[model samples]
Target: MKLCTLVNKDCSKAAVLFNSKKRILEYISELAHQQLPDVSKHVILDALMTREKLGSTGIGKGIAIPHGRLQGIEQILAMVLVSEQPIAFEAIDKQPVDIFVAFIVPEGNNEEHLKTLAAIAEKLQDKSFCKQLRHAKTDQELYAVIQGDDNG
Candidate 1:
C-alpha cells in the first residue's frame, strides 16, 4: 500500500512541534490508538524502543522510519512527523533526522508490514522528496508532500 493510504491529513503534524524521539514516538502511539482503541501505548512504545535497541531507524537525508509490531493490534497504523530542527538519532549516515514516519503493525502480518516499510523507505530516499518535505511549512503542505501530490 502507498504511504498516502496509510497516513491522511489528520496524521500529519507540524515540523516545529516534534523535537525529540520521545515526543515523536508518543505522537505515533497516540495516532495508532486512534485507529486501534484497544492498543496499549506502553506496548507500542516498548516494541519501538526494543527495535531501536537494534539500531536507529534513521535512513538519512533528513528521514527516519521507525517501526514495530505487536500482537494486540489487528491492523497497521502510521504517523508522519516533521521536525523544524533535526534531532540526533544516530542515523546510519551519521546525520540528524528531521522527518519521521512511524508504523505499528500486527505481529503476524509480516508480509504487509515489510511491504509498507519498503514503500516508505524507497519513497523517502528520493532527494527531491526530502527537499519537498523540508519546504513544507504547514500540516496541509506536509500531508500533500507525504501523499506525493503537492500542489503548493
Candidate 2:
C-alpha cells in the first residue's frame, strides 16, 4: 500500500520539533492513537523501546523507520514525522535522523510489515523524493510528496 494511504493528513506532521528518540516516539504514538484508539501511549513506547533494543531502525542517510510487532493490534498503523531538528539516532550509516516513519503491525503480519518497509525504503532512496519531503512547507505538501504526485 502507498504511504500516503496509510499515513493520511490527520496523522502526518511536518516540522515536528523533537530532539530525541523518546520525544519522537511519543509524538508518533500520539498520532497512532488517532488510528488505533486502543493503542495506548505506553504500549507504543514499549514497542518502540523494545525494537530499539534489537537495533537502530535508522536505515541510512537522514532517514529512520522504527517498527514493532504488537499482539493486540489488528491492522498496521503508521506515523510519519519531519523533525524541526535532526535527532542523534544511531542510524546504519551513522548519520543523525531527520525523517522518521514509525510503524506498528500485528504480530502475525510479518510479511505485510516487510512489504511496507520495502516500499518506504525504496521511496526514501530517491533523492528528489527526499528533497521534496525535507523542503515540504506543510503536512499536505509532505503527503503530496509521499504520494509522488507533483500535480496533487
Candidate 3:
C-alpha cells in the first residue's frame, strides 16, 4: 500500500520540538492515540520501544522510520513528525535524526508491514521529498507534502 494511504492528516504533526528519541516516540504514541483512540498510548509506546530493542529505526541522513506492530489494529496506522531540531537516535550512521515517520500495523499482517516499510524506505530516500517535508511549517503543509501537493 502507498505510504500516503496509511497516513492520516489528523495523525501527523510538524515542527515538534522534542529533543530525544524517547520523547519523540512518546509524542508519536500520543499522536497514534488520535488515530486509534481505543489503543493505549502506553501500549503504543511499548510496541515501538520493543522494536527499538532489536535495532534503531533511525535510517540516517537526518530521517528515521520508527514503526511497530500492534495486536488490535486491523490496518496500518501512521504518524509523521518533524522535529524543529535534530535528536540523537542511535542511527546506524551515528547521525542525529530530524524527521520521523512512525507506523503501527496489525500484528498478523507481516506482508503488509514489510511492503509498507519498503515503500517508505524508497520514498524517503529522495532528498527532494524530504526537503519538502522539512520545509513544511505547519501540520496542514506537512500533510499536503506527504499527500504530494505542490503547495506544501
Question: Which candidate's lDDT is highest?
Answer: 3
After TM-score superposition, what is the CA distance of residue 22 in candidate 2 from its true location, in Å?
A: 1.4
lDDT by residue for model 3 (21-71), tens: 999999989889878899999999999999999999999999899988899
For model 1, residues 1-152, the per-residue Cα lDDT tens digits are 77777887877876656667777777777777776778777887888888888999988777889888889667677778788899878788988888888888889987888878987788787778778778899999988888774321
Clashing pairs in 3: none
Question: Which lDDT values do the candidates have, in the order given?
Answer: 0.80, 0.82, 0.87
What lDDT tens digits, residue by residue, belong to model 2 across residues 1-83? 66867776776778988888888887777777778887787787788889999999999889999987888978788877888
Number of the top TM-score candidate: 3
lDDT of 1: 0.80
What candidate 3 gets wrong by more than 4 Å, as runs, is 149-152
Give the root-mean-square deviation of each candidate in angstroms.
2.6, 2.2, 2.1
lDDT at residue 135 of model 1 (Cα atoms): 85
Which prediction has more favorable TM-score, 2 or 3? Answer: 3
- The TM-scores of all predictions, comma-separated, are 0.88, 0.91, 0.95
User: Among all windows of ten consecutive residues in candidate 1, which has the lowest summed lDDT?
Assistant: 143-152
